[model samples]
Target chain A: MKVLIYGSGQLAQMMYLAAVPLGIQVSAVDVGNHTVVDPISKRSLELSIEDAIEQADVLSVEFEHVPEDLLEQAQSSGKLLPNSEAILAGADRVREKAVLSKLAIANSEHRIITQVEQLDEAVETLGDKLIIKASRDGYDGYGQWRLAHIEQLDSLKNTLSQLDLQNVPLIAEKMVPFERELSLVGVRGLQGDIQFYPLAENLHHQGQLHVSVAPAPDITENLNQQAQLAFKKLVEEYDYVGVLAVEFFQVGDSLLVNEIAPRVHNSGHWTQQGTDTSQFENHIRAITGLPLGNTKAKGKSAMINIIGCDDYSTDLLSIKNCHLHLYGKTVRPKRKMGHINLTGKTYSELAEVMTTLAKFLPIQAFPKLLDEADKLAAID
Target chain B: MKVLIYGSGQLAQMMYLAAVPLGIQVSAVDVGNHTVVDPISKRSLELSIEDAIEQADVLSVEFEHVPEDLLEQAQSSGKLLPNSEAILAGADRVREKAVLSKLAIANSEHRIITQVEQLDEAVETLGDKLIIKASRDGYDGYGQWRLAHIEQLDSLKNTLSQLDLQNVPLIAEKMVPFERELSLVGVRGLQGDIQFYPLAENLHHQGQLHVSVAPAPDITENLNQQAQLAFKKLVEEYDYVGVLAVEFFQVGDSLLVNEIAPRVHNSGHWTQQGTDTSQFENHIRAITGLPLGNTKAKGKSAMINIIGCDDYSTDLLSIKNCHLHLYGKTVRPKRKMGHINLTGKTYSELAEVMTTLAKFLPIQAFPKLLDEADKLAAID
Candidate 1:
């Protein structure tokens, strides 16, 4: 089967690699801005995007942010996997929050703010502390504002009022004091069969994902059920087909939905090394109407993002059980260059590998890994 | 670093997949014919072969049979891994027999034959029952002839004498009535560190590899030692770098060298799902001077080659612990389509999965699977 993917980035590159061995041909739009250079050969193509898409058996997105017109074209063709509506829901916080509310699923308490006056009422109803996020065009902390106290709401409102909030409204949420952050990465097949990877504990730095440890340490039955329950509701409601990642904030024993990513996620990267079938492969499988692969965890795994570092010594691979995935992207500060997946027979072993890996990394390039490594060591 | 591979086939494609995550660029010559279509994009390239060669940091062969001239050019550059001499030894049975003799290794009692007149002497020295193999360009039972007794030798001689045997000679061997076939897949790094995967029990049908069970059932310390000793001899003698696969015939308490492939072998495919690192990754690692990865087997694994069929339902992936690797090639009779690597917690579990898989496959496509399944069931 042939697959056409929207947004040719590192995620698309990985999907391309994963799809090839399955005998599934994958081509990406906007990869060469229509010229479709082979990702491996670095050679330009003679095929046009029209021909590429027309030949594709299925259309999917590598990320949530493909332009709407192209998405509409794919949608009209009725070949889009997971559908454009689901992609839009992930792209827009308002729609995602509404989906959560409509399903009666637990999530952070929030109120949409369209005008400056609504911020006052949002503060009055929600709490003193707030996380104000733009409904659209926001990710990795961009277009997001946090309110530590009600006193700062006016300043935030003043800053927000200058921007045109008509088309993109703000979601003012009461920041919950959660015990930890976790995510469930799962796939929904065309037959509506759902299979979820074990919950992964996530660590964030500067509003970007820094690390993910799978089969999250000290997971309780209660937490597992809650995440699965949330996942079931989302998949069933959307009739979703393809990989969907749902981030959650664990408040004590209760798990509340944080947001959903309709594509393969970084938090699920651990599955590449930790599971029999990776999330990337499962995503392709689901999109192409293949049965979902087994999601059984092989062992404990930790994935540390290689953000903005080009200085990674190939020698780092010399370390036992350390797998490096470099994205081959030009290094820019805060960019996700790639990640290192360290798997072991136990949490302690993974921790030990992580600690050793930290020693090899540049402190500036790895802003959050050292601290995460320290936590893993403590766990060890 | 950039890697240039001699052959552009499934091995090169898999190597391409394995190397991408390591941030290494691999360009394969002779893959898309002289055009060198990018493996990832499947598009023709604009670059010249010389430019591709000059851009490469290391040159390696996906198979031993690369043209001698190309091997000479790569050898002159001093960038070839495993080197041309090792490849030539693997290509020519005479050279291989010489290496075995030099290393004092055990092999089938044999005599080189350059003329049809030598058959009678070979029979007198060896035995009536013999296996004769071509010295060059032979695989999968091709370029082979067999003799059951002296009476049959006349007919074989009549047929053999009609062909020119000047350049390419044959090796006439007394057919050893032993046990099962096995292969040792191992790697030697540029730093001289060597790692060997456990022996794999290979099952052949019509002289083609059908299935391989890794950490071969009923292996003992003596058998393991014998294989490792032979490996040590070959690696040390050649000062080899990159993966080498050696096929062996088990006879009682002894093992005889059958042949050697100076590149990753089909027998190592189980490593994809059954080891912390795969043979493909190790090959790239060894060539690029990266540290050799762990060769520890994960539980047990069996790999079944998908030959001459593309009707392989992706649903086979639905089987637990089963991973399919399809070569993106046109379907043809007797062509190796791809392979399925099934990993399990025990020999019994792997056996069970294999048996279950056999039921789903066409009988024509899987001649040995049902029998292997039955054996596995008995073991279970």
Candidate 2:
């Protein structure tokens, strides 16, 4: 079986690693250059994009932000799993909000704005406290502005007016005082069967994910059902096949949809060490029309992103149940170089491992480690 | 870091898979032609053998039977782990027996025969009930003969006289009635730290391993200690620094050494899904001078080889905790195609999973499945 993934990044690399044992060959596309490459070595394969698509049994993307022209070409092949529509919904915030509204899925109250003048009415309707975002190509806290008071609205509009709003548009969301950030990573098989890994609590620093803990502590049964229900409605509506991630904001006992990612997600990386099957493997199985492997967490696991630094001691592997996954990339500030996965029987045990891990990592690069470790340690 | 392995087969392929995440790149030598190739795709690399050797930080092997010339070349590089002496000990039964004698390790009662006339003395000393083997280039039940009575001696001598006994020699052994076959797979690190996975009970069909159950049922503390003691003695004797396999025949409460493999063995494949660290990764770590990962088994597990068949239903994955590892190979009678790994919390549970797995496999390809499953199910 041949799977052609559209992005030659860490996710594609991981998918390639997971696919090999199942007798699947994975070739990755360097979207920046339209060159096909081996996911591990990034060495270009002697094949054109058209030839790769022709030979592929299935076509998928590692990220939602793949170029539209490439996505359209892949869609024309009739082998793209989850389809381009689902991917577009993930890429465009306006489309995502529309999908949630169409499915009657609970999410944050937001309004689409295609003009700079719309910001005044957004503040009046969503109150002065709002988070305004670009409708497209915005991620990791970029292309966003915060409105803490009515006085900041004019300046935010002025900043937004510097760009062509009508082309990409904007989403003015009420800044919700959510209790915590949680995400549910699930896969929908070709037969329409869905399996979900337990919710993972996500910790972010400077708008990038730094750490995630699976089977997030203090989760209520109702919260889990709410997350799954929203997930089910969205995947069913799109006839989605493959892994999809839905980020959520918890308010009291309810979960409000924060965003959706139509790919194997970073929050699900914990499954590599803490579950019967990983999300990457499940995604491949879903696209290949195979049975989805188990998604149940075997134990509590924490995934700590190795961002912007590779200076830490590799001896951290000496810790029991600790595993490192380096992406074989050179370091750059805030770049997601790789990640560390630690599994333990309890949240406290995971925290202890994380604490030990923190001692080996530079605190400046991993800003959320100590705080997240403290929170997990306090869990019963 | 880079690792170059001799023998481009499934073991090398698996090592490549395990090494990628550790930021280690592995290239394999197709020993048949001295070509360096990608272990997964088997594509010939752009580099020559000399260049590959120069680029590799460490050299190793996936099997002990690599040709002597290649072994000598690797040894001269001073990068080969376990050393060529250890590998030669595994490849030549005569040298292996010498090592056993030097270390005072208990083994089968046997005599080395360098001439056809020595067979008469071997028969007298080992008795008529014997198993005779070529001292070199023999494996997987090949190059062996058995004698059930004294009446067969003259015919065996006539058969042996037609060959060059002086070059290869022979090992004539008294065939003992053994209760079971068990193998201990372990790794020795750079600093001489050793770790062993629990012994695995092996079941063979036509002298090829068909199934292996790890943390073998009915193991007493004394049995485990003896296996580890023999392993420690051999590794320390050679100053070995890689994964090694010690096969044993259990006679009453003692273990008699059957043979040793200088690289990852088939019996240790169970570690891929059943333990915190797989033998492949540990071997890489040992050669790269990194700290070894955990070796403790997570639960009772079984590894069933998929030999000479691809007709089984992939739906076996629907069986919970079951994983398929298909080595991309053309089917041929008696050839190893791949394996299935199943893990469960108890012996009975693993048996139940194996029974479900058996329903999806052809009986001819998995000759020992039902019997082994029955045995495991009967365990308390």
Candidate 3:
């Protein structure tokens, strides 16, 4: 079996690793070069995209932001999993918001603005405090702006006017006050069987996910059901196949949709060590029509992203259940170099491991570690 | 970091998978051709063996029977883990028996026969029922002859006389009646730290391992200690680094040394899902001078080898906690095609999953499944 992935990055590399033991060969298209490459070695496979597509048993994407032309090429092969509609829902905020509205799913009060003057009306209707985002190609806090107050609307509009708003519209979303962010990472098989990893509490630093604790502490049955229901509705609506991540904001008792990622997600990386089957493996299984492995969590887990720093001592592996997954990429500021997954019997135990792990990493590179560790330590 | 393993087989392929997540690249020596190749893809790397040896941070082997010239070349690089002596001990029965005797390890009462005339003395001193084995390149019940009764001793001697015993001597021993065969798969780090996975009870059909249950049922504390003590003594004596498996024959309350493998063993495949870290990953960690991950078992596990068969339905994956690991090998009689790992909270649960799994696999291919399931089902 062979799987071709659209984006050649860490996610594809991970999928390749998971797929190998299942007798599946995974080749990735370096969307940057539009050439097929080995996901791990990044070596050109010397095969054209057409050849790869034809040879693959399934086609998938590592990220939602794959170039449209390339995605179309993959989708037209009739092997693409999750379908192009699901991928586009994650790629374009406008399409995503439309799906949420059509499904009557709870999300932030938002308006799509194609013209500059519409920002004023968005502010008036939604709120003065809003997060304005580009409809496409927005990721990791890029292509976004904040309207903190009514006073900044003119300045924000002036900044936004530099772009062709007609070509790419803006999504002005009311910034809802929420307890914290949680992401439900789930997979839907070809047979419509769906399974979810426990909701993970995500910690963001500078609009990038820094750490995630799975089976987020203090989650009530009501909250879990709400998240799962939203996930079910969205996947079923798209007839989605493969892994989908729905990021949400817990506003008191309800979860509001923040975003959806149509691929294996960072927040669910803890599943590599925390669950019986990782999200990567599950995604491959779902797309390839294999029976999905168990999704049950083995224990509490914390996935701490190793951002932009490779200087940390490998001795941190001495920490029990601390597994390092390095991306084998050159260090660059804010690049997701890799992640450390730690598992424990309880949140407090996970916290202790995180605290110990923090000592081995550069503090500046992992700004959220100590704080998240402190928060989790107080839980039990 | 890079690791070059001798013998491009399933073991090396699995090590490649485990090593990738640690930012390590693993290449394999197709010892048969003496060419370096990608462990998983088996693609020619276009690199010479010497170049691979020089580039790798560590060198190891997938199988004990690597050609002597290749082992010597690897040892000359000063990068080989477990050293050459440890590997040679595993490759030759004579050397292995010598090492056991020197370490005062309890093994079978045996006599080395470099000439055919010694066979008659072996039968006079020991029992009439004896198993004779070639000292080198013996595996999977091959290169062996059985002397079932005093009357058959002359015939067995005639069979043995046909071989060049002077070059590859034979081990003639009384066939001791044992309760079961168990293997202790353990790893030793460069820093001399050691950890062991729980002993696995192996089931053989026609001398090929068809099933293995880890943390074997009905184990007493004393038996476990004896196994661990033997393992510690052997590894320490060799000053070994990387994973080593010591096979034992449990007789009454004691365990006698059967053989030792210098690399990861088949019985430990259950670690892939049933332990905090697998034997493959631990071997990588050990050779790379990294701290070893926890060796604690997560639950009861059974690993069923998919021998010479690829005709099973993958729906067995629908069984909770069952994971399929296919080696992507073309089926050949007695070939180890892949393995399925099933984990459960207890023996009974593991047995139930095994029973369900049997429905998906060919009965002839898995001769031990139903019987082992019955045994485990009666355990708890």
Off by over 4 Å in 3: none
The DockQ scores of all candidates, in the order shown, are 0.77, 0.90, 0.88
Q: Can you write out model 3's per-residue Cα lDDT over A70-141, one digit (the tens) per residue?
A: 988888989999899999999999999999999999999999999999998998898899999999998999
Runs in model 2 deviating more than 4 A are: none
Residues B1-380, candidate 3: write the lDDT tens digits: 99999999999999999998899999999988889999888999999999998899899999989898899999999999989999999999999999999988889999999999998889889888888999999899998888999888777778888999999999998899999999999999999999889999999888889899998988899999999998998898989999999999999999999999999999999999989899999999999999998888888999999988889999988989889898989999899999999999999999999999989988988989999999999989
Going through the candidates in order, the fraction of native interface contacts each one reproduces equals 0.87, 0.86, 0.92
Put the candidates in lDDT order, highest first.
2, 3, 1
Instruction: Looking at model 1 chain B, report the run of 10 residues with the lowest lDDT sum.
Output: B36-45
**Top candidate when judged by DockQ against the true structure:** 2
Say which prediction, candidate 1 or candidate 3, comes out ahead on DockQ: 3
**lDDT (C-alpha) at residue A7 in model 3:** 91
Cα miss at A151, model 1 (Å)?
4.0
Q: Which pairs clash in model 3?
A: none
The per-prediction i-RMS, to one decimal, reads 1.3, 0.5, 0.7
lDDT of 3 at B199: 92
Over B203-316, each residue of candidate 1 has an lDDT whose tens digit, in order, gives 998889999988888889999999999998998888899999999999999999999999999999999988988999999999999988989998889889998887756667
Instruction: Name the TM-score of candidate 3.
Output: 0.99
